[model samples]
Target: MATLKEFEDALREHGMNMALALLERLRERDRATRTVKPARRLTGQKMTPELARAILDLHATTGMTQQEIAFKVGVNQGRVNEVIKRGKWLTDDPQAPEAVARDKAKARLRGEPKPKKAAVKEKKVAPRRTNQGQLALGDL
Candidate 1:
């Protein structure tokens, strides 16, 4: 019969061998299933200047949402948004009322001064008295 120490050593060796075999089998399976394919470039829909103008015009005149314009123009809403952001629709000489409002909002966010509003005059109220004819704690 093997000694207690010999038995423990044999068991440990067997467990290690089993673990290594399992890892090797997993590696082989992974290698068999894995395919090495060439990375493809991501191509998105390209918008021309005319298309951008049309999108802006539809949004401005028809009150159409970005999603609606994207659907009509065969592009994504994000692409439409990008075109609108970079286009001259907002920054050009023919600034739309919405563009002017957007510019004002941007300027306000940048700490630019806007037209001051008329301040309302506050009315002062008399202090409250308790039923005992003493001043209330809140008044104090």
Candidate 2:
């Protein structure tokens, strides 16, 4: 890839000073579009029973906002509201008792044990490298 210096040199040679203004305008448009978009979607992590109880207690006793509870519990505010409304940590609609029983029976017939919570893995970021193949100290 051409370096920034090389790009600037090429622009100068071509007498394209107005191109810089166009580039700046394009960058501003990109930034504006990005800021106008909604926040990222929530990760599809299920709330544990203990977490649900904690959310309910916090809401009842302290009258904390759903967003606050969500921050404390590491979930989205919608999840906090859902748990408060349903009285359970469920990702979907509550099944009828008979339907639940039938599902359990089918699971047993298929020799499937109840699912357990999977551990959340932390993401590791690679160190940024410069064009010259040296570590980028700006990140540090």
Candidate 3:
């Protein structure tokens, strides 16, 4: 089946200017009728006790899925799952696992270098040899 774009291309190929103009007018009318929605959060926000509570409340009170709850709360879906299922980030304690992880992430974001692990020495590999137009055509 030909798509609208394909049909438009065909019309253009056949020099149907009137039909193309009509499509443009229709597109303009459709755009005019479309309702504008407020921009959604693109970046995930730092998860707090309040945010976790909001996620839990949404999970318990509404039929919203983890992704929907995450979107509404402006956090990761996995964070939402943790709050709903495992009950992480429900406290303001800095020693909590989620809080520690969030602190580490913030540190990394602030350009602080993480503690380095013990370096493992890798075995050196010899480069492979290749004949570049040096072998005769009959050489196998």
Candidate 4:
């Protein structure tokens, strides 16, 4: 309950050491009475697509490694791969590459005119029994 003037007078009468001790106690009391919050975690939450694109672009163009960029962006280094490669691998959706590729093949087979379809159909049926001798992966 010491007033500022009283405290000042007391400090003058006492010593600097006593004043510093009192100041420390006052600071402690102030902290205890106040709703002091903890320091915030520096890890950011989310990165927008534009930010992700920028980060991946920076990784692709700069000397800095993906790990360093991921850390800066508050994401895993693998996310750098996903971001750069698109969601092709990391995606869990059922409509991914395998399904889409199947759909495309089906479409290509069904899209051509009836004559070509009939020809391809006959070839598929009359094939030499082995999938060999065709334009395979090497042709691709």
Candidate 4 per-residue C-alpha lDDT over 88-131 given as tens digits, one digit per residue, 9 for 90 to 100: 33344457764466467777788854323334333355545675
Question: Residues 1-140, candidate 1, lDDT per residue (tens digit)?
Answer: 99756755776787877756666688799999999885332343455557778888888899788988887777788868976786644334436654577678888999999978899899898787656575788987
lDDT of 3 by residue, 1-140 (tens): 99999999999999999999999999999999999776687677887888888888889999999998888878878989888889998999989987788789989999999979989999899877775467777896
Off by over 4 Å in 3: 1-6, 39-46, 50-77, 116-140
The Cα error of candidate 3 at residue 37, in Å, is 1.7
Candidate 2 lDDT, tens digit per residue, 5-103? 688778888999898677768879988888555545456345666777888889999968999888877888887887888665532334845347657
Query: Would you list the C-alpha lDDT of every candidate in the order shown?
Result: 0.72, 0.75, 0.88, 0.67
Ranking by lDDT, best first?
Answer: 3, 2, 1, 4
After aligning candidate 3 to the native by TM-score, how far in Å is the CA of 17 from where it should be? 3.1
**lDDT against true structure, model 1:** 0.72
C-alpha RMSD values across all candidates = 13.5, 27.6, 13.4, 19.3
Which numbered prediction scores highest in lDDT against the true structure?
3
Clashing pairs in 2: none
Off by over 4 Å in 4: 1-44, 87-140
